[model samples]
Target chain A: DAGVTQSPTHLIKTRGQQVTLRCSPKSGHDTVSWYQQALGQGPQFIFQYYEEEERQRGNFPDRFSGHQFPNYSSELNVNALLLGDSALYLCASSFGNPPSGYTFGSGTRLTVV
Target chain B: QKEVEQDPGPLSVPEGAIVSLNCTYSNSAFQYFMWYRQYSRKGPELLMYTYSSGNKEDGRFTAQVDKSSKYISLFIRDSQPSDSATYLCAMGPSQGGSEKLVFGKGTKLTVNP
Candidate 1:
């Protein structure tokens, strides 16, 4: 089955700009989550969307926001991006609310210059 | 201190060797543990998932969780060059995938052929 798919494999943005990254969950998956991974670090949870509603969130600020669609697709939007925001944005999908194993996409490499 | 602590090891070993990766968490409520593999510029691929304080095995990979100690581990057997990648440990506190996953700084490994 097709796994999670992310768009614009790479991106470059200036400081204070905004960026939107897209993700399509795997077939039959119903939940989507976003994560950020800095260089030499592991993925940090941003938020999770289920049933088109954000069900859970991490410690990140409000600048990092996300939306889930009816088709189970998702979008991660960052506002007023800072250089520190430059990292790999990953989207993962699972089947249920408390999914056991999540499928991940190759992720969007966001570079805030 | 960080919620999850992992040694970001650029661990190197020869092929056909055994590799052990580990992570420790400060949260006792973490109910699910997972290991993910990621190559450069790629999203993390789930390697192993386990709940409870025991061991689970899949092919050449094994995962162990010690809830009492709040430690989790992933072991790769007969490693190959293809196994070379960054290994990340993630945990969820509430009902697994429905909640946010806290991740550790990945451990980079290079299996030399």
Candidate 2:
């Protein structure tokens, strides 16, 4: 089965700009979550999408938002990006509730100049 | 304090050695624990997961969870060079549909041949 897949493996954008990253969850999975991983750090949860609605969110600011399409694909949008936004954007998929059967994509490396 | 705490170790061990990685959490409500392995410039891949307290083994990897102490561990036996990567510990509450994961700073391991 195909694992979770993310688009634009790497991208560079200027500060104050906006960026959009995409993700396709693994087959048979319906929930999608987004995470941010800084260099030499573990990922921090951004938010989670289920049933096409954002269900839970982390401590991130409003500049970060996400959407889960009907087909279970997801998109993470970051507006007014700062240099600190330069990190690996990871997309994860799970069958239902997470902490089980969770899979992650290779992630999109966002570099804000 | 962070909900989860893990040593960001650049742990170097010779090949074929036994390696133990661990994380401690302050949240007792976290019922599901997971271990993820991430290579450089790549997203994390789930290595093992455990619900509540117990030990689960897959091949040379063993995951142990102690609910009373709120500690979790991942052990690798006969380690190989390919096992060199950052290991992340993640946990979430018992919610069924919209559980969000809290991750610890990853521990980097190097298995030198």
Candidate 3:
């Protein structure tokens, strides 16, 4: 069985531009959540998608958004990216209402220039 | 104060040495505690998890949680160079409600051969 997979292992974007990172959750999982991990720090929750709708969000600004497709894949979109937005974007998947434990992808490294 | 606090240490130890990592949380509501290992440029992989307050062991790794003190620890015995990575501590509330993991800054460990 395949674990979570993320596209474009590494990405480079310029300021004011927008970028979208994709993720396919592990098989048999339904819920998807996104996290931002800055260098030298732990990951911070961006948001979570369940049932194709955003269920809970962190303190992130509105510029960070996400979507969960019917197939349980997820996409994280960051608009008007800033230099500070450069970080590792990780996707985690779990099953059902309260995720027992999350399985995370390798993550997409976003570099803003 | 941050919800979770951990020392970001580039901790170095000789191979086969026993390693101990810890994290403290300010939120008493957090019911589940976890430890994740992340290699450079990779997403975190769950290493150990515990609920309630006790010790859970898996092979050379042992996880201990002290709910009364709001502290959690991960211990590695007979560590190897492959064990060198950043260890992250994460916690969340019960699964029935919103499940969002709050993570610590992570402690980097290097097991030198």
**What lDDT does each candidate get?**
0.90, 0.91, 0.93
Report the lDDT tens digits of candidate 2 across residue range A2-65. 9999999999999999999999999989999999999988898899898999988988999999
- Quick one: ranking by lDDT, best first? 3, 2, 1
Report the C-alpha lDDT of model 2 over B1-113, residue by residue, as the tens digit: 87899999889999999999999999878888899999999889899988889999999999999999889999999999999999999988734544888889999999999
Q: In model 2, which residue pairs have backbone atoms overlapping below 3 Å?
A: none
Candidate order by decreasing DockQ: 3, 1, 2
TM-scores vs. true structure, each candidate = 0.95, 0.96, 0.97
Docking class of 1: high
lDDT of 3 by residue, B19-38 (tens): 99999989888888899999
lDDT of residue A46 for candidate 2: 92
lDDT, model 3, position A32: 91
Q: How would you encode candidate 3's per-residue C-alpha lDDT over A1-113 as one tens digit per residue?
A: 99999998999999999999999999999999999999999999999898899989988999998898999899999999999999999999998644678999999999999
DockQ for each model: 0.80, 0.76, 0.84
Candidate 1 reaches a DockQ of 0.80
Indicate the residue-level lDDT of A102 in model 1. Answer: 87
Model 2 residue runs over 4 Å out of place are B94-98
